[model samples]
Target: MSRSHIALVGKIAAIACIIFIVFCICFYKTIRTGFIEAQFDRASMYMQGEGNPQDFKKAREYLEQSATAGSDNAQYMLGVMYEKGQGASQDFSKAMNFYKQAANKNHAKAQYALGSMYDHARGVPEDHTEAVRWYEKSANQNNPAAQYALGYAYYNGIGTTKNIDKGLQYLQKSAENGYVKALFYIGSLYFEGKNIPQDTKKAFSYFEKAAYKGNHDAQFYLGVMYENGNGVKRDYTKAIYWYEKSSKTHSSAAFNLAKMYKNGLGVEIDYNHAFELLKRAANGNNIQAQYYLANFYDKGDNVPQDSAKAAFWYDKAAKQGDSRSAYRLGEMYIDGRGVNENFDKAFQLFQQAAQDGNVQAQLKMATIYFKGMNTPIDHNKAIEWYQKAANQNNSEALLALGNIFDQGLDVPKDQAKAVGFYQKAAEGGNVEAQLKIASFYLAGTNLPKNPAKAIEWYQKAVDQGNIQAMLALGQIYEQGIGTTEDYQKAFEIYSKGLSSHNADLQYAVGMLYAKGLGVSKDIEKARNFLKKAAQQGLVVAQREYAKLDLSNQVQDPNMQTVISYLQEAIKNGDAESMFILGNLYLNGNHVTKDTKLAKELFMQSCEKGFENACHILKTTY
Candidate 1:
């Protein structure tokens, strides 16, 4: 009875154990499937706002759960969210971790993300080798971004030796996959012709593709190509179109547009429109625009001359390391034109611009040091700055050096050094330097006299429309100093100076007419020439006019006017006029006889070196 009871109980116990094990297995399978499905469904719903409002917090929670459940898509999404702070605080470490997890599972986007993180040193030390490795892995899986990244790395030799062929191949793959940046890069490579054969047609094609996809850089480059006729025929119309599009975001495009408007390249020359575009570019922090706008304001070139506005734009460009703008601003400070007078500030700005190789600034610094502007005079410093400017072939600086050497101002006088500097400046087209060189040669005072050389330099100055040079050249021709006497040439040279309204040229022309040296002597022409010189207050011309007897030839009113003009000239200390009036009084032609007055006038004229008056005085008194 005990054996049968024990065997039945053992069989029942074994059946119970087997049923319990089967039930536990079924429960585990149902719960695991339900948990994974629910996590994924909820993450997708929160991420895409499907059937609910998008909630980053909820999305992050569900994505984390799904990622924990081994969902590669969820891991990649979590990486993006963490990186961009979309569904959580921005955490590069978390982003890297999630990206690594998904990347291990062969997720292309996650691999690309990991590559970018390594490339930029986000959440890790920069490792270009690691970045290239990840990019290659993702690129092999047909990831367009990764393909572009790998191509750039090859092109730039980021992690390996540069290979243009491999770089272009990878870039072509990315472009085929519709990567806009890759198309732009390929266009730039072709356009720049660096490490690749120049192919404008190919560049234009790639640029067009990216530009149509709203790539601002591609559009800007397309404008540049059109404007420069590099990748297309020179077409300002097309350039304007592309530049307008890119100018929405690119300041350089705006700057180029302003130039086009100013020069009428693509549009009618409209200074106001150009100014507007320049302002826009300057507001966008374009350094060149800032400098040019400052110049426009400073010079009142189509804008009101507002010193404050000029200073503002100059400061903007100067801060960006524009040497010309810095120098201009320094000038404004020194002259209190557009800024408060601050010698110290001006010196600082001049020094900065001088160091930046601004020739004008170097000259200004030399002048400041030499003149002791807000500082002790420093001749050595002045010499240093002047030499710097002279190295750039600045004519003014050379002229200053010549003056310093010739005058022996703070240095030993050296006429040879002065002549050398003057020659250099003359070659650089400084008219004053040419005059100085001519004087040195003509007078034989500073160097060996060479009238031929003097004539050559004088002619150079005359070519530049220097009145003094013209007069000197005329005198040389009249005196036969350098070449054979040619009265006709002398007359021509003197005639050229007539346009300058110089009194000396007028007097010379009148004398030529009176003497009949160049043309047939005509009394009317001589009188007209003398009248012109007299009107300009030439004493000799006034004296010559007074000597003419025009009481019957000229009307009484005209004679009175001439007499009054001569009297005025005498009052102004015209020695020749005094002599002529003394003769008139002595002859009693136009006034009551007064021998005392006539003698007094003769004495005054004789004292001022009137040779005729001196002779008359010696013969009579």
Candidate 2:
């Protein structure tokens, strides 16, 4: 009962002292936490005006007190209040200081705020490296925004040495966390093959993921990929679906969808739908859509033909540097199709479009300058514009240049240069140029005569259905110019020209039948062909048609029909028709004798240079 009892009493006393100290520490911490929370609550209430007047001054005071007491949330709030100048003078430096304090305490939001300040030089010296440092801290804690920022910095070498692999790795992490922008960037990198092997399939997959999350850009890309078969089989149906989805926000998507609808791709042709889509895209400021929409209004393709609407759309596209639209609008101004005719405005627009390298506009400029359309004619300017357009291999421009040189219009005649331009135009598929070149070779004009070359160029024009070339070729063959005469070939060429219904060609065929040069001699056939030529007001044919009856020694069975045909020719001012009809009336072969009418017809024909009619009038009267 002596030493053991004293030791047990001392141990009990020590255990009681430890328990009292622990309780005092816990009570003190609880009170401090409650006080900080009360301060923060009051600050929030004052800032938000909870049942009281909003007092930013009082809110800042309470937030400062709470922040000083080591509250990370309070520190971040104080930074915002200082930055915004809520009841205090705005001080970025002060805001940055508070953000730094909270950031150092491992507050993710504060770390991101500090990163943005450094990145954008907001309240701090611009330092991408420092920004990356802070962003990394927050990113490591799974902050999607910070992760994206850090990835972008690495990818662009903004804050660190460029490391595409590392950047993609961080971006993938952010994308996995559902960051829409991160997904889009990653997809773009792969799609463009920037600093990495192009992986369209992978890019498409990532874009699809973002598209499903309502990213308009991603949706547009998905449409492009599907339509072009970039990484998969081309699927117009799917492409249209994606394009329609993105068309609300993406003008390019709307334009593409409109084109698809217009071309009947992956759907039934619906011009009305195409028109609506084009209107949407044009309103969104798409240059191509505006241009095509103008064409639709001009042509009455889907909408009622509206010249005013065409001009409006053309003007919109022209302002955006569309050369074709500018040229078309210029044309409208000149024609007064939609607006009052204003040649000055048309000239100005044409000049603008010509300078922009529109081939048609350059040609128009040449024409206007040469013709002096609503302005003084300047042949030099016309030549300059023609040269410009010719330089672009415009066939019509080359043909125009040839004509200018050949005609010596405002320039010394240069037949060699004219032939050169004609040759160029012919090679470029200008049928008129081909015919001109052929004529040059045939007539030995401005160059050594070459029949083979003539035939070659003529054939080129003939291939394009040039009736003049066909007749020329037939004449060449029939006359045996620098070649053996081939009547059969001449007949074939003349037959091709028959579709033109040209009086000369019809007479030529009649002569061939009469002489049996290119066809069998048949008087009936010759008479029929000559009759057709005579009805078309051919003077030589009408004279020959009248002489044929005297040579045949047999009156035509259809004398009244011949009289009617001659009457029609006379109405067309054919002197030969008047002379023949006058002779018929005097002879009374087809009608009762009327000497007075016959003398009047003879006098009319004599006035038109019919020598036989004058002789008959002088001898009979």
Q: What TM-score goes with each of the models?
A: 0.85, 0.72
Question: Compared with the true structure, what per-residue lDDT tens digits does model 2 show for residues 381-448?
Answer: 99999999999999999999999999999899998999899999999999999998888888898767
Looking at candidate 1, the ten consecutive residues that score lowest on lDDT are: 548-557
Clashing pairs in 1: none
- The per-residue C-alpha lDDT of model 1 at residue 146 equals 97
Error at 447, model 2, angstroms: 3.0
Candidate 2: lDDT of 486?
A: 91
TM-score of 1: 0.85
Taking the tens digit of each residue's C-alpha lDDT, what string does model 1 give over 1-621? 599999999999999999999889989877866876788789888888999999988988988888998888889999999999997899999999999999999999999999999999999999999999999999999999999999999988998788878988999999999999999999988888978898998999999999999999999989999999987899999999999999967889999999999999978998888889899999999999999999999999899989999999999999999999999999999899978998888888989999999999999889888998788898888988999999999999999899999988889999899989999999999999999999989989786899999999999999888999989999999989868887878889989888888888887887787778887766667778878888888777776765653434334435575787688788889987787778778889767777899999999999999899999988998
Which residues of candidate 1, in runs, are more than 4 Å off? 1-52, 163-165, 197-202, 268-273, 303-305, 444-448, 516-526, 547-577, 605-614
